[model samples]
Target: MERAEQLFVETVSASLENKSVSWKEPLTLNEWQRIFYLAESHHVLPMVYETVFRCDAVKKTMQKESRNLLQFYKRMTMNLVMLQTIKTQEYLELVQFLQKKGIWMLTVKGIICRELYPKPDYRISGDEDILVDKTQFEKCHKALLEFGMKPVKKGINIGTEYEVSYMKSGSPLYIEVHKSLFSPESEVYGDFNRFFMRSAENPARILVEGTEIFTLDYTEHLFYLICHAYKHFLHSGFGMRQVCDIIMYSNMYGEKINWQLLLGWSREIHGEFFAAALFKIGKKYLIFDEKKACFPEEWRKIKVDESLLLRDILDAGVYGYEGRERRHSSNLTLNEVSRQWNGERKNPVLQTIFPSLKSMKNEFAFLKKIPFLLPAAWLIRILRYEKEMRKNAHKNVTDALKIGNQRIELMRKYKIIE
Candidate 1:
């Protein structure tokens, strides 16, 4: 059965890799039948249905796109299968255990909202997200340990310097213990807890096995999802599955979402402008607003730097993973350097550190000043970035120096006359 499931997953993945369910490929009956058969065999009937529905929507004459539809439907079917396999009792049991200790923890994206929908499988959940008081982190960690959930602290835990940012610890249940809701890297220069706590405003309380657990109120949950995505620039990939969940929740529980309250919460976490941008973009791309949620007067007054956010969103997506190389067309090497310098593209020290000759030439002022800097400044920058480079298995100052020398020699050969 496991082998069958694995084979089915691979086949479905291959099908979905064809990027045209909507625009071009019209899927055919044979493809739908194969997907449905696999989905049913795996008890993933819901996924099969979604894929079938998508297939029914395509135009058969659009031959290539029709083929894409077949593949996309199969992918959706497999995604539904993956989502349903999560332990339903994990949230309820954890809530019960914490309740025994008098610790109040509010659930976020992970499993809480996952089950909120009529068909939770449609939401496509990955990890369990919960927010708790800083004081309770140790207790939560201990409790999670009792349940045999381990912490997946791959990167250095963010904000470890700050007492409140101690977020980590996955469990047998497989979860991410967040000190707060947002990514620690992006959490800088912002007060995240205030808005995160405000999720309690219209909190959704549920009783499971005689214990009550509170989650973000439905409307607030949807708004939180939007803000979280905007924070990372809708580049969540499968994480956007959460956005789809929110849309389903919003459409399902329309009145529960107080637009004003949701926007107010957004303003507190991100500036009002950021919140406004999030709402506008969320409504624009994903699920839409039918009742037309009221925007604060301040939201209208706020200025949006689309160009700036576009760059940020692109950066976030480009380097979504650590040491992730961008596609060749994007100048992957330069993108890596850009992230290494902490997104300040023209910081002169980086030029000496990596000697990106092209970028240095672009920032001519930095170049002119670089020649005048004392050798000590050059040493300090190299030493600092070198120590940093030693941590990465990739190019260090030595590699850059070698590459730079080779370029100089090659330039002399080509008569480019560097």
Candidate 2:
């Protein structure tokens, strides 16, 4: 079994066994191996463990029977080791550089993921998800440049940190510097007041080897997780790390989170049910203070399988599908549409029909209620759109149509479409 995979199991077992783990040290090899076995027996190897570990270790440990699990992690950005080193080192540098620049940023996911394992080496990550005060983001970005860092994308590509992403390569690590915490696509994301009003001011935290790692208060973290999970799930599915994120974070900081705080954040984010479902799932795998919990009817209604679906889909997006192009267009591809669907920009008059966030959010709400209905609706829409697509699919479609009889002859001759 791979070390990180083993660590995931141990982390979960630590939760199950009610043990605490330290993520900055190495454990005995036996401890690592047994934990992987535990995670495997629980059937969470690929979906759960794959999120935090690097791929080479998977190859190093689980060679035969662990093939599928190994492959899955490889595809999901096999740069956990590189990410960790970069994050800790970059953060240390960023802290110093920003102090000189008089800018302060908080570390988010980078340290949180590592904190879940017995040592940073046992788990893996790809980026340092950091959050900075929106007002100071530009200054922070500027400060980063002085330290030889740059943002990963521009103009709404989105990063985990305030501005997000600066790379140095042949080296591992992508730093996601976020301006805000939630996904930009979320319904309330643009409303600064809403986030601030519901945000936790100075939540309880854990110290990892003297570095202060901050997280949402128990209730607050629950709120953020629910909103985030639902936000991602609505987009595709929640990434697998999200599930573990809720599991691990909630477990690690269970005492500080509370139900009322969760309710406030969820309502603010308009993800009340999402937060509830995540809380319900968290409770199953870990223990929380019952006195502080406010399990609702909705929470009990959410199935674990749904959570897993959200996790898998979300992880795929973060990690991306490498061989999708080679896999011939399947029924799902032709029928079900996503943001990645094929289409070209046309003149503005026609371009107004381009799908917008409102339409996507509406679709997301509909799917949550009748989750299986999306495929049929998508198929119907595909058949309707296919006609439009043929014209847009090729610049020649319209030109070819002008040839009249010759076009039909060629259509038949080429078998372009029945």
Candidate 3:
């Protein structure tokens, strides 16, 4: 890590752990600006602001030299309060409406995750995720539209195994009704069925704005969080905000969760290696307390390539935006096929060439209105996105595959995957 980032991490760790941060000398304006930018990118600016308020040296330096940063902090605090208020109200209304419709919705992440923060507003959330049963998905979706939430045309899903997003007309809250937690290509895709079943059996009811709503049970939620982070790690990258969520969640429900059960579940989903690495990172960077849960001695001690891991985390700035580079058309297509046709991996290229009927229709929504013109629409869709598909086709294949191979090798080295 760069020196400024290292210092930012150290300062955040001290603040989140409720320890005093004693800087040898007051930070320069430029150094403080860099720290602020890094914290913002990682979605930890509020937490950093709290630390700044607590430290006499930092507070004095900010007041004397970084007036703009202090003003930014003040503005952030105001916006945080307003946004939290809006989300809380929206959460209550959405829950009431869903309950009336008899839709089994289990809230995940977003405001629900923020409840685990030191201050509810410290962890900023852009959207609300509510998991609904596949059986009632259509009904729930229709109800959301009726309740004033309109769907965004693209980006949430390219296939069925993903969430559908909705936004209110004049509100900032973007709500996603999740049919499956992750995309088909994600490592944790196989575990969605098990998680859904678990959610049905052991629902966690949380009180939001005087109304009660359900969320994932502690163990399942923790495992999901790990898998969620791992998904980002593999694809683009994720930031410290995600890491902080895992640590805060673990700390909040230490004894309530059965670590053995979670570990076994993670292994069943091929997530044991990744989970262990995440826990180790959490401990090192977020200062996760060892007493929270009984982590496996061997897993905890599993050596990690810090340089590589940190690079992935930092590059995935605030929800995988920073490190999103285009891939070759063939690589992208192959990846999609492997994800969607997990059982038929022996011939991914062939499977991709002849996609399933439902998949084809969904990709070309025009087919829904004109069934007989499906083939033409399919051709049109490919033609429309062809330029996008071949964006990085000129890059050397070896270079494109190198990064993926390095990630796989690292995972193997840590025994995260076979």
* Top of the candidates by TM-score: 3
lDDT of model 1 at position 30: 60
Model 2 lDDT per residue over 38-144, tens place: 44433333334533244344335544445554455455323444455666665655555665677665566556656665455334555666667677777777777
Select the stronger candidate by TM-score from 1 and 3: 3
Ten contiguous residues with the weakest lDDT in model 3: 323-332
Q: Candidate 3: how large is its RMSD? A: 4.8
TM-score of each: 0.52, 0.54, 0.78
lDDT against true structure, model 2:
0.47
* Candidate 1 residue lDDT tens string, 1-418: 2333333333322222222123244435565455445454333345325433433244443566545655666576665556445444555676677778777778776566555444555434445667776677778767765755555543433235122222224423545666667543331212344565665456787654466668877766777666665433322111223334445456556666676776566554433554454344345444435454333454456555433332233222222221222211122233332333244545433443544433332223233345444444456545765576678655544444443344333223322222
Ranking by TM-score: 3, 2, 1
Over 4 Å off, model 3: 15-20, 57-65, 154-162, 184-191, 294-307, 326-405, 416-418
Q: Could you tell me which 10 consecutive residues in candidate 1 have the lowest summed lDDT?
A: 321-330
Query: What are the lDDT scores of the predictions, listed in order?
Result: 0.47, 0.47, 0.67
After superposing candidate 2, which stretches have Cα over 4 Å from the reference? 1-86, 153-162, 183-193, 197-205, 213-218, 267-270, 285-353, 356-418
Query: For every model in order, what is the number of clashing pairs?
Result: 13, 27, 2
**Which lDDT value does model 1 have at 117?**
44
